[model samples]
Target chain A: MSLPGCYPLHDAIIAEKLTKYYGDFLAVDHISFQVRKSEIYGFLGPNGAGKTTTVRMLCGLTRISEGKAYIYGYDINRELVAIKKLIGVVQDISNLYMELSCYDNLMFCAEMYGVPRHQRKERVMDLLRFFGLEDKKHVKFKELSKGLKRRLAIAAALVHKPKLLFLDEPTIGLDVKSKRQIWNLICKLNEKGITIFLTTHNIYEAFRLCDRIAIINRGKIIAEGTPTELRKKVSGNKIIELQVSPPIKKSTILDNVDGIIDVNIGRDNTIYITINDAIAALEGILEIVKKLSLEIVMLNLRGADAEDVFIRLIDGTEKNIGSSTRR
Target chain B: MIDMLRLEDIIKAFYIAKKDIKEYYLKPPTISWGIVFPVAFTLAFILKGGHHAQEIIPGLIALALFFGTTSMAAASIVFERKIGSFERLLLFPVSYIGIALGKTLSSFMFGMVSLFATLVVVLPFILNIPTYSLFLVAVLILSALMFSAFGVFISFLIKDPTNTMMIFNSIRLPMIFLCGIFIPISSLPLPLRLIAFLLPLTYSVEATRFAINGNYDVVPPIESILLMLIITILLILLTSIKIRRTIP
Candidate 1:
């Protein structure tokens, strides 16, 4: 009854070969992913990659063209009303009522969700404080700063205490400090056992926060795994950077080098290489240096991280893992 | 059934509607549409009437109600759509019918409030008018509800505020002239009479006139009330269907 190494024992969110078409153009072409309860699941994709459309379908804002999604245990189509009651969404854009004050907006949402009058005020205050917008409770939504407005939207989404939460770029357009605050709040909410399904274009955010991520492009999921598994799959466990002189015909030399898979030319004639083992690769590069009498200005080694895997997958050079793989 | 009325969803709809209508009251242009324009039209007609002043009182009241309801519904939906507040409403637990009904009720209440103001403005002139106050109140309330639903139906068909106002004015001008809002139906020619009888306001005008003049016109007054009720029920049904289709 429990998923291994995750909070969502049962699938909190599930999409099976989901496809969406707008008129003739295929916006989403048979993508699928599962999000576990209490796990911060990141959906990473470029703009126009059908991430918003996918989230809308799961939230019941748009009908799926093919396949289906399930929230908690209910089908999105058949049990929409029940599913809607359980899930809450903070959209990329501000969906808060602008004319209303912070308290009024939350109160309106709470009333619509049928939260009892006796506890409504307490719930509003608690959510406001949680998002660090307690001081702006009396301010109109339009008057608040962009960060506070986003915080208000988060509070509005959680007003009903929905078990499943969807956050679509919660930190988009926010300053770095505001972005950190929102991320911290999101982490705290996940800690309280709320299942989070988030979509973002920020690679580092996904790498740092998500337990598992699905990389989508052109509506199809190109890759899916933990950050570590994905990095290891694309190149290896480490990255090696070597700065050398001009006339760098190291392509042939680097190709024959052991423990190295691929190399890319960095700025200032620096050569960055992906390797299976950092120490062995460094030793091989040292041997090549000694034999050729090559002078190395700088040599650095680091792990192959999510950014490496992402570029390779999108660059059309990654190995094929499944029949549905694009490149 | 009353318990159903007291459900949190229904109450929340009313709360939203009340908030929206109150905001409209605060806005100068919206206040003119909901209160000033309707009252102004009624006064213009009252001052223009000679011997037919008594006959025009109920007609002006119906006019006030019609303009008041249509303007508010059209304005509210267009404003919500413009600012993306409607999307927020869709996220709530409330059903589409609750929203339609709530907006309709608020429009109806606002129309009646404006009508009451118009009646007070015209009171000094109609000294000979009989006070069948209770019957008049009931008839006016029914007529207000009927037109409010009609307004909801109209609002859904429009997408732009400017175009909506243009369309509302185009339809309102002819109806104000042809629906016996400013003239007696009996005075109109036969073909126009048949056309006038088809409009919901024609029935409301007749019923309200009877309630005012104590005419007790045998067949027309009773038939008018029944026909208005029928039209209102049909409009509410249509609004419900349209709203349901819009949910996705």
Candidate 2:
């Protein structure tokens, strides 16, 4: 399917070869992508993959070493002030003032964003209620539980009702329940017409929440697509595992079988087979086993997921969409 | 839009200052370092002898202001930077000068508070110590502002809290010796006198001495005041530059 326009008119973010270098070391190699309006764009990468570096550049917290980026048509380098007004950032760590209570933290953020005094109280109260932090409004940020602290951090970022929100690992260290609550909050925020740029390493989080995901490795983007689209990158292959009384001594027995991609005989008399058409090849596989007089004990077939694609891309087994490897 | 931006900068700066004052300036450790230590040190001088006790008051006040402003500013900024909150401040729409000014003003106010506490503790005990109130207030304000700027400058230059405190102590302790705080600059050797001339605290102490005694032991009081003002402006400029380059 083709996008409607040459340039995405509804894009909230656009980067043109955005790059960053620390002295001689390149932290973010030239990488470019777009985030559409009102969509949750997930930025996934391994450690030291420049995911945080890219987000920091877009938010104007770090200077770009080369190339340029624009947030809602405002150049990040030249019009940072204008861009800052339209965006809110929740860093990986809770950056709220620990000494201040939850209410004061929100009020302070409101003040920073220049929310009028008359509306500041209402804005803060609304955020407290929205994040379900109203009961802990008077509690100091340091005294709040890890879950509450994360909630208050997100609440603080929303004090100004930013058009775009940059969330860096919002639910990184939260309990399962807390993580689910934040996911719901993120969904609710997006429902109200806010675009979200999220950077996370949690595959499930990205898979469940992001409208689109871009996987980056070693400062370069290796793949960009929806979760299902990425899964399809390796969908041509299927995994079939079989247990037999005696493992086949010659792995070449299935080499000539139609639709069989590869076969690996493992310890404990287990046979692993990769095939193109599992339904068509199942008979051939069983025929070989019967001829060898191997008793079939167990069998299982599995499909690929986002985690598999991620591993393949990062491990250099899958070629990048555009062959972006640098010499 | 420009007017609103300026207004927002001012408001954000105020919020940062308020938060810092509550979080750092009013804390027990800062209060003790700024107030209690200076009072105790000054009292030790008073108890030792009444002959030169009046002369030591200005030095004590200067000492309190120096430690009060520098320690609080350095500790606050280093702590914020270490915990990653300072980077969040950079994401706000405020300019670098606004952030520097906000921190400087809060530290300055804390310095003034410490100066006030020192005076309240010592003034009633001293007799016949002539005080020119106008010049005294001028000297106090200028010294606090200049030292606050110095504190902010040093904080921006160093990242670790321990290293900042060490540098501050090394610079301030040596300055106390060279600035004629405890002894007359004229009585020092020529080489030491040149060193005293290079120190900003020298002018602050001299101007303060003139404010209390109606005469300066070194250069004229007016010259010292003007020099202190010039140094304050320069320090503010240096602080702004450091913040701009180092923050992002």
| Winning candidate number (lDDT) | 2
DockQ of each: 0.43, 0.67
TM-score of each: 0.86, 0.91
Instruction: List candidate 1 segments past 4 Å from native.
Output: A1-9, A237-298, A318-327, B1-8, B186-198, B215-219
Give the worst 10-residue stretch by lDDT in candidate 1 chain A. A318-327
lDDT of 2 by residue, B122-152 (tens): 7876675657878889898999988888888
TM-score computed on alpha carbons, candidate 1: 0.86
> What C-alpha lDDT does candidate 2 achieve relative to the native structure?
0.81
Candidate 1: true contacts recovered, fraction: 0.39
> What lDDT does the true structure give each of the candidates?
0.77, 0.81
Docking class of 1: acceptable
- Contacts from the true interface found in each model, as a fraction, amount to 0.39, 0.65
Error of model 1, residue A126, in angstroms:
1.6
| Worst window of 10 by summed lDDT in candidate 2 chain A | A318-327
What stretches of model 2 exceed 4 Å from their correct place?
A: A1-8, A241-258, A262-273, A292-298, A318-327, B1-7, B26-28
